[model samples]
Every structure is written in C-alpha cells, then in structure tokens.
Target: MIIYDLACTAGHRFEACLGSMFDPNPDCGCGASTSRVPSRLNLGGAANAGPGRDDMPTTWHGTGQGDPATLKAWHGAMTKRERLEERYPELAGDRRPILAHEGAFAGRPLRAGDDLVPTVAKAAFGKEES
Candidate 1:
C-alpha cells in the first residue's frame, strides 16, 4: 500500500492509501479531480530529501530499543492500550490494564505466558539454551 497526498481542483488537500502508483486518481470528494502531490516518507531511516520538502532528518540510526512506550511510538502504533489489545485479542477491553513495559515481557518468547526477570534469567538459563 502507498499513501498519496492529493490536492483537489477545489483546493481540498488530503491523503489516501492506494494499491499502486499507476492506479486511477481517486475522487477528491469536492466534485473535482485530485492530483497527486509530493510528500516525504521517513521509513526505516531513509527519506526523500529534496528542494520542496523541509524537516530533513540529520541523524537517524538503525532500530531503537528502550522503554516500551518509546518503542510503540517508533512502531507508529496507537496508544499502549490499543497495541496490547491487538497483540492479545482475548484480553481486549479488559477492565484490568496491562502497561506497555509489562507487555514487553522482558525478552521472553511470545504467547507462552512464561517469563523471567533479568537477574533470575541470568542465573537459571545459559546463552545456548533456547
């Protein structure tokens, strides 16, 4: 999928995710034909930096790892609540809440309901162990 920034003849500006670049122009909803306008995408640390666009990122490294909330923002996901619901569908809308850090499960394998704290993990498991 691709997001196209479109501007209508009636002066409406909007974006839509379309299947292909060659796909027919989508209606601009203002009874006018929309034209694909230029936009910048900053994904995986690469972006189109050209004369028309500002906000050129000077420094961006590979993937980042830190607090779960920051990671969620980097993942471009919604709030912690929504991500947890998506990852654990049965727990959706639970009156009880799970914080993002807790959801990380501290490097444990996913969906197994088993985890270990750092100190305990170092003591009980070895590097070669799965």
Candidate 2:
C-alpha cells in the first residue's frame, strides 16, 4: 500500500493510503476535491533500496531470517516454563527439561502442542516427521 499526503480546495490536508500513487484523490470531509501532494513517505527511506537494505536474505533465527511468529511463540513458551519453574521449585514435571535441541521449532523449547518448523522437523527426524 502507498500513502500520500493530500490537500483539498478548502486548504485542508490529510493523508490517505492507496494501492497505487496513480489512483484518483479521495474525497475530503469538507466536501472539496483533493489532490495528491508530496510526502516524506515517498522520499528516500525504508521503501527504497539502499546499500544496507540490499543485502541477500538470510535463513536463521536470532538473525532476522526466520518466521517471527514461530520465534515469538517459542520464546513465549520458554519464558512461561522458566517462570513456572522459578515459582515452583518442587513441582513434579518430566526430567527432560525444556531443551531446544530435543524438539524446538525456532530457537526455543517446544510446548505440549507446538509443532516444529517443517524443515527443522525433517532435519531432526527425517521426512516422516515433516
């Protein structure tokens, strides 16, 4: 989506998001016609290619290369487990401990119902696991 700063005939200014810059101006609340104007978003920034942002994509966790939701869920589960263990030292649980190398998806331990990343599962337990 593209956002543009627009000005109406009545001198009112507002921003609108459009699928393309060539789209017609949107109606203003003042019942006046509007025209697209220059904005900072169209300037040189995140949307444009640059020396640092042009680097090749990577494929690892902790390096901006993996699925963010999976990574977040994994860490959330790990943090919850840690808090539980801290609150209840004598709580009865499996001795395996939450280990990432066992059945983790991204970089954290897998919970009771979490599934591993497809490639990671296949790599850890062959194609059948995937």
**Candidate 1 Cα errors over 4 Å, as ranges:** 40-130
**What would you estimate as the lDDT of candidate 2?**
0.63
lDDT of 2 by residue, 1-130 (tens): 8878899999999999898867888999999999988776544546421222113234484435677776676566556656666676554255444335453345544544445465456646656451
Clashing pairs in 1: none
Candidate 1: lDDT of 71? 53
Q: What TM-scores do the predictions have?
A: 0.32, 0.31
Quote the lDDT for 119 in model 1. 33
- Candidate 2 residue pairs in clash (backbone atoms < 3 Å): none
lDDT (Cα, 0-100) at 108 in candidate 2: 48
For residues 28-122, what per-residue lDDT tens digits would candidate 1 score against the true structure?
88789989988976667754222211221223432233555555554453344456666767645333332333333355332323343553444
